[model samples]
Target: MADPSNELLASALSGEGQPSVVQLHGEESPQRCAELRWLYPAIKWWKALRLRGEEDLNGIDAYAASVDALLLDAWSPKQLGGTGHRLDPAWLERLEMRICRDLPWWLAGGISAEWVPTLVHQVSPFGLDASSRLEHSPGVKDLRRVEALVQAVRVNSGNRG
Candidate 1:
């Protein structure tokens, strides 16, 4: 979730054990990340950046450096993720020679087994994050779809290997 209060983030980190992954979703601004830099050591930070348009290309290096990894997800000013919209692949293409050249990043939103090969070939992300695409309904996962996505990634990876 985005805009998590520092108190809540800290509480989650200190309670029981640290989460294996702590993603900051819909968080695109570097200043916001800088404000939360104190929590860096306590969590495995992964920033889920919303690709609104060309403007998002600004200051991406600082954003990438602030976290352990990056996730490039589709965004609409009207929605808070899981919008079932595809990000403009051209944005990723524009970035291929720049920020994407050395960052550990992933792609998310409206992803499915069929798109994996094309996306992998286009962006070469560290991974893929499937959400609404694998769901039978909001908050309900479809086991078969999930399994198929895994198989697709495995097969595609083997082919690439």
Candidate 2:
């Protein structure tokens, strides 16, 4: 839901032991994330940034100003996310300096074990999401691929900034 009502968000968060972090997966717009944050002062909102053509990253700091974190993913017309698509590093290179310095972001979409070294070198995301890419089929992950990805992350962990 791109713009879930304040009433809906409050209702979801009403009960006891509310989750500390919530990912706005159904929401694709980055600008609306700040508005959601404004509605919920206590909860941590993780906004998924669906990167598309001409992503107006010049004002990203304003777009993601007070959010807890951001998730970088490729924008798909059919799928809101989990599309198994990779974001172009050339365009992402421009975002390295544009995103808010303290706001951590996780890289998603077409991340694979083999791409880790290059990803660590080109992008500075705080984390990576490889569930769909490391899977042999839907809901079943290839352990070898998962291991390779884990190993790759470990190998490149020290190389990141």
Candidate 3:
């Protein structure tokens, strides 16, 4: 979930939480992300995913200083998230060198086994966010597909560990 309320995030962090990456999405500003981080210092904030075109990158880059990772997702006209659409690879390629260097960024938006390995090589994202492609329906992920994709990326990367 992206841009969750501060109360909800705080409650989740109150438990035995580990250092996890949280991707801020939706209409959240970098200032808001900073506020949430201040409210809960236990959680490590990752990149924020903006829906707008290249324009959103400015806000994202501004906030990137405080985050541990960056993620680029597709924008849609109908819904706020889970649009099952892929972002412009070229756009990511251009920004890959400038914004997220040395940061662990993940590529979201309908990634699959067939495309994940190639995109991983092209964009060189730290990982792939597989959601719609491995889902039997909306919000229901297919484990088999997910496992296959994990295997594929690992094999392609020659990462046996």
- 1-161: candidate 2 lDDT, tens digit per residue: 45567787788888988878888776545556767777777889887778775464555566567578878789889887778888888677788777777888898998898999998888888889777888889879999999999999998886854
**lDDT ranking, best first:** 2, 1, 3
Report the C-alpha lDDT of model 1 over 22-44, residue by residue, as the tens digit.
78885446677756665456556
Kindly report which residue stretches of model 1 are placed more than 4 angstroms away from their true locations once superposed: 26-28, 100-102, 158-161
- Could you tell me the lDDT of residue 15 within candidate 2? 92
How far is each candidate from the true structure, as Cα RMSD in Å? Answer: 2.4, 2.4, 3.5
Model 2 clash pairs? 85-110
Q: Report the lDDT tens digits of candidate 3 across residue range 31-80.
A: 77778778767667765474457655554567675666767788777765
> Which wins on lDDT, candidate 1 or candidate 3?
1
TM-score per candidate, chains pooled: 0.85, 0.85, 0.79
Pick by lDDT: 2 or 3, better one = 2
